[model samples]
Target: MKIFSENITVPASAIDENSHVNNITYLKWCIDVAEKHWLSTAPKQFQESHFWVVLEHTISYKNPSFEGEELRVETWVTLAEGVKSERSYKITRISDNKVLVNAKTVWCYVELESQRPARITEEIRALFL
Candidate 1:
């Protein structure tokens, strides 16, 4: 699978009372990167037929990130099963290469109109794999 990586700069607004990036913000970063990765691989028809929904997420915070620090967020598909898939993320201090956070999320394919589970296509699977 292809892992998508993007650089992010910590902004003053992202800081919390403790003067570090908020824990929830890290999860948002993970979600954003995962969406970007999906868009890159999915076709326009896929967007019209279905949407992916997060079923579960597990996040681990290993270190703190401060404002003005440069970070890299990476995401990839770890597994694809029947109508569900697992995505993994890593946030790291770019210069030092220290992983600040890691997350794994389970997502389900859903038919947009019915809002029910739907099977994924081989074309979609190939794009992700």
Candidate 2:
């Protein structure tokens, strides 16, 4: 499977009271990378016609990361069918290659104007494949 990846440096703003990257920050990163991949790979017409909404998210925190750490976030679409698909992510600390987080999110496809559930088209699936 082809994976889309981005590297991000942990900033002070992302840290929480626990002194590590906050849970919410991880979620934000996941969505950001996913959206980026979709926008960069999908056709313009498809992009303007469809949007996605998170239906579910399952994340595991395996390690803690500190400020100034460079993190590599990699994501890929695992399933695409009907009105929904699944995307998975692995966030690793760049220096040590420690897997800090593993996550999967279920997203529902929707029409941009109607905001109603839309079926995934063959062309859209091909873009990811």
Candidate 3:
């Protein structure tokens, strides 16, 4: 599996009333990394012709992360078939190597102009593999 990863230092704005990273922030990070991975891996023609839409998203929180902490965000394709693909995400705190969050998202591939579901082509699948 090809894992796409990036790191970010938690900022004050990401913290909420509980003084920890907000739940929505985690979701945002997951989406951001997924989009980035697709943009970096897919060819220009693929990029122009297709895009992904979220069908389902599941997230589990293991621990709370605080501002100033460096966290690694990673995502990879777990499954792909027909018109959809499943991707998994993990957010870990660097200092303790503790996983703060784990998430999975089911994305439906769509034709950009037609706005219709599209089957995954072998070339697209190979990029992830």
Q: Which candidate number maximizes lDDT? A: 3
lDDT score at residue 93, model 1, on the 0-100 scale: 96
TM-score of each: 0.96, 0.97, 0.98
The superposed Cα distance between candidate 3 and the true structure at residue 78, in angstroms, equals 0.6
Indicate which candidate wins on TM-score: 3
Candidate 2 collision pairs: none
RMSD of each: 0.9, 0.7, 0.6
Question: Mind giving the per-residue lDDT tens digits that candidate 2 earns over 1-129?
Answer: 879999999999999999999999998999999999999998999889889999999999999998999999999999999999999999999999999999999999999999999999998888785
**Of 2 and 3, the candidate ranking higher by lDDT:** 3
| Backbone clash numbers for all candidates listed | 0, 0, 0
- Runs with alpha carbons beyond 4 Å of true place in candidate 2: none
Worst 10 residues of 2 by lDDT: 120-129
5-110 per-residue lDDT for model 3 (tens digits)? 9999999999999999999999999999999999999999999999999999999999999999999999999999999999999999999999999999999999
What C-alpha lDDT do the candidate models reach, one value each?
0.92, 0.95, 0.97
What's the true lDDT of residue 31 in model 3? 99
Better of 1 and 2 by lDDT: 2
lDDT of 3: 0.97
Error of 1 at 108 (Å): 0.8
